[model samples]
Target: MDSPHGAAVKAEDFGLKGPRGWAFRGVGIDAAPGSLIAVEGPSGSGRTCLLLALTGRMKPTAGHAEVGGHQLPKKMSAVRRIAALGPVSGVTDLDQALTVAEQLREGALLQRHYGAPVRAMLRPRAERRAAAEARIASALEAAGLDLAALPKGERTSVRDLERLESVRLSVAIALLGSPGLLALDDLDLKLSDTERAEAWALLRSVAARGITVLAVCSEAPADALVLRTGPVDPDAPDAPQDAPDAPVEAAEPAGAEGDTKNDTTNDDTNDDTKGADDALAEAGRA
Candidate 1:
């Protein structure tokens, strides 16, 4: 869209614990505005949790972070306003039933209605519609998504998109908000070597445009600022005895409140699933 106006992102001693263990802990990152950062770890290592925590989609139990000039936990609402999530399973998942064009239209509309200034909303209907179209066009161009290249063009359902196409679509939608920081999950999941290269290049281009990018990947690429996560040391004195059973969901409307209950058993199931997936990958490599 417009020239980059990326905001600096920083975290110190950031940690998030769940009942199963520390989803991620002792994490620290100092990324300048417009930097490309990769959170690298195998499944169950809490990469997703880290992504959510940085984007203000999940709360951190300890430590502190600043995103887009907003202090997290304290100014989470403000952080959420300047940061956007793409393809974060529980946070920004695309609707499978929708067509690519439909998704783009909806994302632009949501951004305009939820993120635009009140003065902008007071504009004439035709002008607002035109502005939305301009934004979608800019995002599409910047994301390098050619909707017409898809099998069914813009009418292609999200369920039908190839892995790379889905990634591009999600990036395009996230761009509609013109956010200062963007977070994406599963950056390299299910992609061939060539596709992986393309994805990395795309992300690099995004960073070059002035949007700080935080991505979750199974392995970090050579070009990114990397953060590696490991299993929690239970014997450590700082180990948390009580932790959230599940991750807190994304932000609700301002002033809205919700409670997250502990379900340690469910947490175990999630851990098991992640472990199994990691095992399968390891076996395939062997």
Candidate 2:
């Protein structure tokens, strides 16, 4: 079945409340095929939670979401099959003891074993190994990852690699499965300007291949569809004010709609901040 976005994700009136408070309330979004929709907000503004909900990793308290033509709960398995999530939480998903090539090979084998029927699974072991190896190479190349550059090349242990390399490995693993919808969280959290630009280019390339990308970021990219949220004015009374500016402010949505295009362009060109890049390079070199 076709997804709400004609790709593989749809959320309507989705709400999630945590122990602290509501992460997102009455949030609704749709992503069409090949489109990149970005969710922009402050650190604690429920972007990650929303992403989890839409991806079927977390159930919502209210409203509905669909992935891959199946209603959330009813087709969760199917949704998972076609959706890939990359979250930056400092926790490596790869097995630290395993080499990069081993990790990739294992991922491909597992995907095949789970995705195919009993008959297909019964195929000769040699053929299966050949197919898995091919998939691993393709996924790595697509993500611009060069395992051979490591100290031990493809044999390099995950634990020995730099944080950025590990992150790239996770991205390669996610791409190995070829999911129709890709959800990325904190993509530019601590990367250098050059690294972030390269990452953005990689993401754009993935989207160009007809995948829908929904990412949560502190700042939105130039071509992203931006969505923002902020604290509601508690001191200001809800009652209508006589001031003309008050009416205009009330009429406009959060973050100001008129600034969308300008903000996008500004974000694209605002590369003056070299401090972040310096910090990221330090981290990468460490």
Candidate 3:
């Protein structure tokens, strides 16, 4: 059961244009809570532009989008409050010199300051400190990041962390404010295969806990709903194979040693085909 009021992102006929030309056109999608939708395309294929539009960071030249029931203003401040974007470029907002704990504390304080009523600021110092600490702890746990493991525990500088660790820390900071939607771009850009798998697993766990996630990638996991983009006539052969100035390479000899090797290997495999089939049948039934 999805929350009717949960973050439901809808983009209708979205389009964007830059100085050169259109970045994207006629893009439409509806993402509900708990859904993992992937946008897949080649480089310079407008994937990032579509992401920015959906997240409310950039407005579409045509059509409109709504996130968590809030329409994007022609401004950034309003959008900043409802969603968090993790860029594929791995640029976390964490201060390089600040420890993980300090970053979390600052994030909570900032959220409270911005979201708090003016009179709440007038409360006693102890009360504010307690409230901030509670929020930070909850957020860190929810993000699955243990600040205590850092070199200086919560006091370790972000500059000391490995790339993956830094990404996790950024996600923790984003979770502190309880955003309605989380958008990740270029999730596999620079990560190793194993690291990328770990990152995807982490994100799926986050989605299971009820955060709406939309990611952009050149390739996506098997379970993701894929949105693909490419040239309109993808199979058309546009290159001229018979152009007047084209170069040609000589063909291999008919009775070459390579042909003999392939024929011998094929004959040996054919002789074992019956035994292999029987083994495969037994394995399948068992």
Q: List model 3 lDDT by residue over 129-152, tens digit each.
A: 887787677666665678777777
Name the 10 consecutive residues with the lowest summed lDDT in model 3.
259-268
Q: How high a TM-score does candidate 2 get?
A: 0.73
Q: Please, what is the TM-score per model? A: 0.85, 0.73, 0.70
Among all candidates shown, the one with the greatest TM-score: 1
All models: lDDT? 0.73, 0.58, 0.56
Which portions of model 2 show Cα errors greater than 4 Å? 1-8, 88-92, 229-286
Model 1 scores worst on lDDT over the 10 consecutive residues at: 260-269
* Candidate 1 structure quality by residue, lDDT tens digits, 26-115: 788899999999999877767777776787656677778898788866766677777777666544667999999899998887777677
lDDT of 2: 0.58
Best by lDDT: 1
Alpha-carbon runs more than 4 Å astray in model 3:
1-5, 72-79, 87-92, 229-286
lDDT of 2 by residue, 1-286 (tens): 1121326566676654333334455666676677787888776556655665565444455567776676864444455566666543422256888988888877676666555447757889998777677777777776678977889999998889876676678777766666777777777777888877787787787777777777778888989876664442334332221111100000011111121111000000011223222222322222
Candidates sorted on TM-score, descending: 1, 2, 3
